[model samples]
Target: MEQTKEISALLQLIDDPDEEVFGAVSEKIVEYGKPIIPNLEDLWENTPNETIQSRIELIIHKLQFTDLAEDFRQWNVAGHFDLMVGSLLVAKFQYPDLSTAPVLHEIEKLRRNVWLELNNYLTPLEQIRIITGIIYGYYGLKGTEVSYTNINDFLLNKVLETKRGNQLSNGILYLIICDLLDIPVKAISIPKQFVLAFQKPGYSTEEADFASKIEFYIEPASGQVFSHKDIESYFKRISVPALPSYFKPLSNKKIIQYLLEELANCFDNDKEHYKKEELLKLANMLD
Candidate 1:
């Protein structure tokens, strides 16, 4: 970061034509971590060759990604996994310089708006309707079907900024709000679908009857509500047996891992396949 003699030498050799030498230099530069980013940026600006600039950019990305991977490791080992923080870390994968304050502010605004409309006596259905109304109707957040071509749909910050996201990202946003409000809504593993369920008060999936514990199912994409019968029909359509494990609420860590796995699908091209590997590595870290 301070541009010591070693750092300077490494920066100079960043243009080395030998693949082995460049790779070695890149590894050492990445070891300096995020603090060394500004130096790399300055180097990129002054360098005339586009090839050298691309090399510098790759080094800078490695530095940021190295830092982000550690953050993911810490999040995995923490006593509690926070949904909002986990989602933000995934966003940082694509946007290293993302400002979290504005995202937090937007979330706070939505939370406060929904909170104001809530009361102690409201039924679970009423409370969910209020959240759905405020989020989809008042805030006008739009949910699109998941598409790997649109990477923005998988990011939390982008979702809040653009008011659009795919099913998984939208479901995560819904989970974060429900968590803050102390509601029992959770994302359940519904097989190729991102679905939320409203667990009845004092009901646990550990109970013998899995379906009975859920008051209703929610479609995160459009804030659409469904009954047990609807979910049954879905299982029948897919020809998959409805198992209790599918009804269990996903942990925050698992949800973020799923997000990363889904996000990796967006980078299947020749130039960006490394990103897919990196994202899958991050997803495996959560395991």
Candidate 2:
């Protein structure tokens, strides 16, 4: 934005010792939206004091977050929510300046590799075998146990860059690729696990006979396939009932919402509590 005298005065008062005054200044600055981000960045560069620099950083983050929240709102209302785009938005929460081109390119490369091995004659299991082989075997995408301490594991871009992610992120990446390929895989509502289900032909999530819809269950973290018996054994071991709702396929929006809620947990510390709040707010928008 062209630096008006009012904006200049607000920038100058960013270092004000009074918290109430600074708060007022921040609200006014944020009202200018993202257009004023470059000016804030310039001010951050020239600022000397670490404390004041932190203040400027907070204001800048607020501006970016306000914009991001709007993006999430729009994603929710869109006729069809693209999983790749939704995941990238979560990545943008932490990496405000993230370049999506690299991420998209890498995903496209993986998609092409998988596509080469796929043919119309292949069975559903065969299709999954090919995808799992390319992604986990050839590409070496590793799935680690979920850890809130490792924030990158929850981000799609970082997951792709490092080739390692927890179950949720790896599962999400798996879903995104499947979506691009027009596969029938979906994330299910199984408790304590991020599992995918390969739906049978001529059946959808809304159909009756929940058990009949799924060809099999897949553990995305390891690309391990599970039979109905295996899933039954799991429920018995966990002492949880095998409820039909647990087998229902989760919508793409719900999957992203789960990601945001889990990502929010990584920011529970005193210094990052605001991040937790913002992430939860974004998650609620998906609801």
Candidate 3:
């Protein structure tokens, strides 16, 4: 096939990922090697559609990546976090087809709250302290044993004890804040680590976050990494113990379902079930 023809076909497969396309492109990139990268660059320059151009750049970057790959070992609970995230996204969020904007708005609100509480002067320990406090305040449910203590120990426990998939530690906070704040952040799924990038809200143009171009990273579920105390408090309302295995990002779309199911789960008693559903529905409308 001609080079331009191959590039056009490759562009079509960028956002798409099926066996035939992914395998063909992956094999071809490996075959053509780095020399074909300039063609990708040239195509990007000529592409008028900004989204397509950016996607082209990402394809180039991925093709060029020579990072180490993981063994996909399941020795511990660390790597299974994505499973929790996927499950929550599927089962908890009511599988909503909602816009990503509101979630981003929530992130902004959360960030401003954190900025108010800790300002920019917080040490790592202090930041953890404040985070734990907020998690407890917002998410603490009943009958749970998770604590808001040992904030730092739990945060770094995985990396400290296990592998160093990614070097940056505070990245979780950055992406969460960006999502909450309504920034144009997108996730890049990479082997062993998920990463994030940011852009302006309007599509077809770009204003990359923190002045960094082509931000890369791991995907974070909205509410994961809630400090121990926060996790405790979050589940405390429901009377369940901490199940790190179960926590994932919460969504407005699913919050109602969670609130309802939780009511059912907690109120086995007849009197509370009927009364709670009526009142909860009323309040949800307000929210």
Ten contiguous residues with the weakest lDDT in model 1: 203-212
CA lDDT, every model vs. true structure: 0.94, 0.93, 0.39
Which lDDT value does model 2 have at 97?
Answer: 95
After superposition on all CA atoms, how large is the RMSD of candidate 2?
A: 1.0
Superposition TM-score, candidate 2 onto the true structure: 0.98
- Backbone clash pairs in model 1 (N, Cα, C under 3 Å; residues 3+ apart or in different chains), count: 0
- The per-candidate count of clashes, in order, stands at 0, 0, 24
For 97-169, candidate 1 gives per-residue lDDT tens digits of 9999999999999999999999999999999999999999999999998899999999999999999998999
In lDDT terms, how accurate is model 2? 0.93
- Tens digit of lDDT per residue, candidate 2, span 1-287? 89999999999999889999999999999999999999999998998899998998999999999999999999999848888999999999999999999999999999999998899999999999999999999999999999999999999999999999999999999998898899899999888998999989887666656777899988888898889999999999999999988888888898999999999999999999999999999999887
Error of 2 at 203 (Å): 1.2
- Model 2 alpha-carbon drift over 4 Å, by segment: none
Best by lDDT: 1
Give per-residue lDDT, candidate 3, residue 258. 31
